[model samples]
Target: MAHRCARLCGVTALGGSMTRCVLATLLLLALPVPAWPQSAPARPVAEDPEITAALALVEARLETERIRRKIPGLSAAVVYDQQILWSKGFGFADVERRIPATPRTIYRVASITKLFTATMLMQLRDAGKVGLEDPVTRYVPELQLRSRFADSPPITLLQLATHTSGLSREAPMDYWRTLRFPAVEAMVAALTQDGERIFPPYREWKYSNVGYAILGLALSRAAGQPYFDYVEQNILRPLGMHDSGFQPTAGLATGYALPEGDAPPKPVFQPDYGGYGPATSLYTHVEDIAKFISLQFRDGPVGGNQILRGSSLREMHAAHWIQPDWQSGWGIGFRITRIGSYTAIGHGGGIQGFRTDVSLIPALKLGVAVFTNTNSDPDELTAMVLELLGPVVERAQQRSRPAPPPAPAEWRHYLGVYRTDFGSRVRIRLHEHRLEMVPAEEPAATPVVLTAIAPHQFRMQGGWASGEVLRFEVDSQGQVTGVWIGAYPARKEALPE
Candidate 1:
């Protein structure tokens, strides 16, 4: 069981007037408002010393870890309910320029932007402009697929949102290297002509950026607005996310540190993808993302008005599909997981030089958003934040529910041999009930323990890859057939008996 700190942190209250004063003070000092309240909440008025100490420890450890990992800079925030408990920036935002990361520094959120895309789709559903079950071909008739399976089933908007559209993780050709903002029409055409369905649509779950790119195009067609413009009007503006948008204009911090020894970070070349972003290109500061997190908590509003209906939020939180092993489930737009007795809903994002994590615990009316400008591991940081805030959230729950036991062993039955079409076979074995994948002919392969997520689904720990859920399929005889690993594009072929 992951240890939860028992220390209680006294809560502090900042009135709306006082918050305004603080903002004014920050503006005068030219310092960023690291902490800002999205809305006032009734809670204990004293800051918890123990909680503060724990948080300090976490911050210190993160700084050390960043240096040790060769990560150049980081900016992070923590929120509870709608209140900003704490936010801070560490290291250099621009290593070459010696500029420190600040609350105002904007970082590429990568796939975390997908949540916004999904939320926009939900908003369209609320407005009766789009249906979740509507066929993709309905909006974009030119959409096609290489395989009959990909084209025959008639992909739905929901499938694209949830990544069951049978599209590859990315386009067959390297769009990142070849093109700058290739037309959606060209992308769909290329996918239709060259893409192969690694798995049958809706038969399993696979994470696909192509799916989201298609969804972005479909949403634009449905709304009769450019993708970024539609999101700005419907989602960003209404959410009061002034600091959040698809592109970073002048005044935003730049020259962020790239991963050491990794590819050097370059300026975003394509204005179309960066400017007309959807799915994976939104830029945001930590405090703004906290506001978004609070809105997700419970009955909170977008732009001080309820934009998503209560039913819609519930549908967003409800499990949309069960993974193959049945250990964890995925909701409409969020990845669902239970840590200890608390249920968490949110997503994690990774780009070249940044990592972002947002988690919401509605039962406690609490949420957390952590953003870093340096590409480093977020798992430990997330665990620490949750640990610091755990006691307070538990107190709010009003019930002493013991931590849930680790997932059961039947979930491990899917562990076996898998062969890739490239004549490579890998063996997934159970060690201490955790799945360890070993590639054949690799003598010293480091094994990544597959953390039980839902049913036959599991995710690897550490970094941006932690939130991905791997699903395994079975034959009629209940033997493992093939496995579709989420995040990565390739599927693992089951080895012959």
Candidate 2:
């Protein structure tokens, strides 16, 4: 008998069609039937030999950068088409104890745990257990906002997922110093009555750890299980991420290096476990995170195991709300950004002693996961990996196209002084057919290259802060009226009268 494979919403379905029964009968009579959907045209996977070399270079560069940056230990993983192509660890996981980092070294993932919490909400939605648009009061009637506007717009699960709930970055309670976990009711009372709204709901994007923590509490109530247990049963168990978990005190890498300014002393083992559990307590290894990324690429389970419904995964990865100027958007559990033509989805996390980033490029079926033990700049490591990976991916894409012409010069109209609401000013000037931006406040005065993407869109290249886009808006007189410095929204300032 012949078997057929069917696809629905990026998931594979097999052995359920009527044709399979007919094929079985025909095989008994020694007759051949038509091929099934499994025989459909196969998509060619793009490969770049340079990727291997580029990854090697990236490994070496990361090692050098870690030392130069004073990062004690780090681990990284790269995946192509849902397959982990490389996973390596460098430096010392615990500098004092002289323990080297490995793929299994556990590091605090910080707010990346928000992604997992958001995914849990999506799963509940798929099971008809909850609705994304449901107000927070539905699950936790005590949940409230410090502002009256909280009742006006009515914070929903969707808003929390995308950070549009207008909640402050944290609750009024000093969870870290208190070191005591508050009951959901107590937390809700504090947030509703004492928490101050930093901005109007949906008016802007402000990353909020409190928003996600609220969602986690709601999910826990809806599932009738502890938050960690629900995530373990629904997400980790099915995905086979055995090395990933909450609490994270047992399996942590020994001799973990501590940052400079924190209290308790250097090389302190068993760091304080504050009350910030739902938003920052997750501890995971590179290999386990690689598995999670693979599941994202497949939009299903790992190793042919179906964990999440394909439609649910799509909803999770889809852009929920875009920031002004389309710099980036927030998906349910991911951040969507365009690199050239490919849309990458992922999130970055940071805490006292760890920094992590995970991104998946579905068009290319490639994923990048980076974890560092020492508290340092995560953006720098992520940029280096992207720089090394971008060219290799582009070369592979070139194979399926014709050689393109060089981009035209785009530095004439946007040279001016731009001011930001945060009391920062940037001076942009044209130099040798290129644009240079110098922060007015910095003393070094190093000129950074700005590559123009469109009429008003540009990116800073080849500097400490690379890959950030700068967009300019012009008025009727062709004067620069507004400028968006980075992923944040653009703030327009009036020209001098």
Candidate 3:
């Protein structure tokens, strides 16, 4: 559980003569008062002691890890809410030229490109132009694949997005092994081979680059424009991610091979995915990816200048397939995992010479993006950043907020642990003017908000019980004795020590 700390400040009251006070009041009333902006600007970075300490730890640890791993160049960014609080780089982007890396250093993000492709597809779905359940053949009728399982269901767009399409992990062209990728027509044509389908649709979870390549073609056909143009004009331009796109821009970092023993690392060739661009071809920096992470937290309507509907974004983040271990699952374009107590949704990318990852905790509106020019795992680095920084940011945010009005004196009666007849337990607590329901077994999970609908009743605002009623049973002396949540009755119990 995240510990909450409250900060108190003292304010001094001023006294003035009645004549001066009247004049001052009149002057203030006559002048105009500007309206507050829709959203507050971000506070300056590293203002809190905890945040400063966390930043220091992150910098020291990141550099140590980079050198220990023998990476050529690496960049990272930490974003809270909608603002980037910290971003820096280490090593050299171009070792031959002796160029130092910075936050703006570009690296091939590889499979992370699927996130943008998934976003574009969700945008098309929300626009009423396509459907998640629609068959792939509906958009790309010319493409066909031979499957060993004759009874396999036709693949849907959702399957492609979630990696349940039964498609091969890569096309027969062996692009990753050969550094030479096929063109659009050639990739689609190769799908007709006898061994293209490795499994029946929905049989199991399988990561497929060919599936996303097909998805990109479908998106292009549906949007009536080139896939690159669609993503550039819609997702990239509106988010102010000017440095992000399919093509490389200035400041592109040189890719390097993993170092062995004490020998210096060797540079590796950078290759484009050609027809599989949506699956594994993207170049970007940490700063620009931070902007994309910010978009994941926004809520708005679908049309006009609004990039993608917030509802669609949530749908994309929702898990569509789960692994047998129950530790990880596949979302639309994201790999969702149970990391400690938090549910993290993000993606990792690895090409010949680059490794990248973007992990976001939407519940906290916090994210971390890491990019490396060598074959090191940036995903693990991203997790390390979160481990060192996530909590400090949370505490700092809690301390910076204006305190909520104290819970009403009588309302405190409802705050306690309650046990149902079936042996389940729940706790009710007041927070920021609302009641929160938390499971006794999972106190660290996000609590369900309960909003008052009557004097002694509340409506669950989230979770599976959302929209259900929760009523309190009060004694003659006005003390809460029990609670009825939906159809179940529970008696109040003393809290644990």
Candidate 4:
């Protein structure tokens, strides 16, 4: 392959401090079939030490976090290239019954629901029934809300989808203590009748739950059915997310809260979604959530149904507006977060007693979903697991990949210690006619061989640096001066030959 290093190579002591494993089983099962109707996934089985060790690290973090946060229930899953590699749960779904949590355990995934809403809207746009640039007035002519920038530009669907519409964060209604949200027509009237003036269209990024509520209303009007109905028929049923819905299902985990004072776990409060089911109402377990995530990674349905065209899904991932304070951007309904060099495009949700995070690394075809009860945050844990996972996958790929081509005789001229200071030197040496590199302090350390892809630049063949390039620098005297690996450069030692 032209880009051999791009393969999911094995893990080592990288960003996550993972231990290197020489013996790893191949992850080369045929491309997995998509998640289907009520179908349970294959049980996780890893004979590879790398995968096993990575999971052990994740389990340790999960247990510690759950105990520290006093979480009642938690569930998580790891996916790669359309396959669910690991799915597990911890703590309890019911404390009284002592029910052990599992991947199938249901939790109200919260605002991750917006991704679904965006999917439906994209579907409408794909069908030519609606346009993203069109004004909300086209669909819901009843909107009473006003904008100070009315003369500048009317709010468009794209702005709402990207959270730049300048709409209020939510509908003005009494849904909180009562648990009874206003009907769709009532919410429309609430915005329009009051003539509430918003910040200004596309002036700055401002997340608005009410704006999404308006989207659901317009989607309902455009599709000639309620948002929930359209989603169920077109998305949930086809995607086989039978356990997901706008209301709690049978056997769903009870929400709980741990207050500041000494008190038993109590039920959590509900902030009425106010007929805006798209912004929050959806509930599901990791099993079902994994199905939706797997679909997002595929270009076209390989062994399953293609929910949306791959191109459209790619369009949704494009960063539209940035949140400088957070150092992240918004991509349609997806919330972008930096995961080292990769970008995790997904969403996180926080209800009174629950917290949720769903992330996808498109470049790696990896997705992670973490759900916790009693409002524990699993974000840090999830990031740790992802960082570890990259190496694990890379290791597996390295083992399966072909060996590197031997280096030419000229390569010996570039072999030596390279560093800014001798105490912190990196050694480059010739091994079996292949160029290998390692830190000077560890002579027995696993050396990653370089594969020649150009005249002076080569990519690593294995270990942590696998697929990364090293370009040797030459001085005016035609002497090797240094080498650049990734973004870091080091000078060659000036010792006698």
Model 1 alpha-carbon miss at residue 379, Å: 4.3
**Candidate 3, residues 272-307: lDDT per residue as tens digits?**
668888887888899999999988888888654469
TM-score of candidate 4 to 2 decimals:
0.71
Q: TM-score winner between 1 and 3, please give it.
A: 3
Question: Candidate 4, which segments miss by more than 4 Å at Cα?
Answer: 1-48, 269-274, 301-304, 403-497
Q: What are the Cα lDDT values of the candidates?
A: 0.66, 0.70, 0.81, 0.75
Output the lDDT of residue 7, model 2.
Answer: 24
Shift of residue 302 alpha carbon in model 4, Å = 10
**Per-candidate TM vs. native?**
0.66, 0.66, 0.81, 0.71
Which candidate do you rate higher for lDDT, 3 or 4? 3
What lDDT tens digits, residue by residue, belong to model 1 across residues 181-294? 576677787777787666667777888877888888888888889888887777777778888887675435553445446655443332346322566788888888887777
Stretches of candidate 2 above 4 Å error?
Answer: 1-48, 146-151, 178-181, 249-251, 254-265, 268-275, 300-304, 397-497
What ranges in model 3 sit over 4 Å off?
1-47, 303-305, 412-454, 459-467, 472-484, 487-497
Q: Using TM-score as the measure, what is the rank order of every candidate, best first?
A: 3, 4, 2, 1
Better of 1 and 2 by lDDT: 2
Which pairs clash in the backbone of model 2?
A: 81-365, 94-255, 144-192
Per-residue accuracy of model 4 over 1-497 as CA lDDT, tens digit each: 31232123322212232221211212322233232222333232233445665666566556556665678788999877667788899889877678888898888877888898899989899889999998988998878576666455777888889999888786667666567888767877877866465677766788988888888888888999989989988888788899988887786787788645555567776565657688888889988888889878878632346778898888899898878687799998998888877787888887777788888888777788888776777677678667767656555544444444556777877888888533468788887667788887786999977778898898987766578888999888878888887667888875423
What is the per-residue lDDT of model 2 for residues 209-275, given as tens digits with 9 covering 90 to 100? 7777778888888999989898888888777888888866555754334445443224533444343
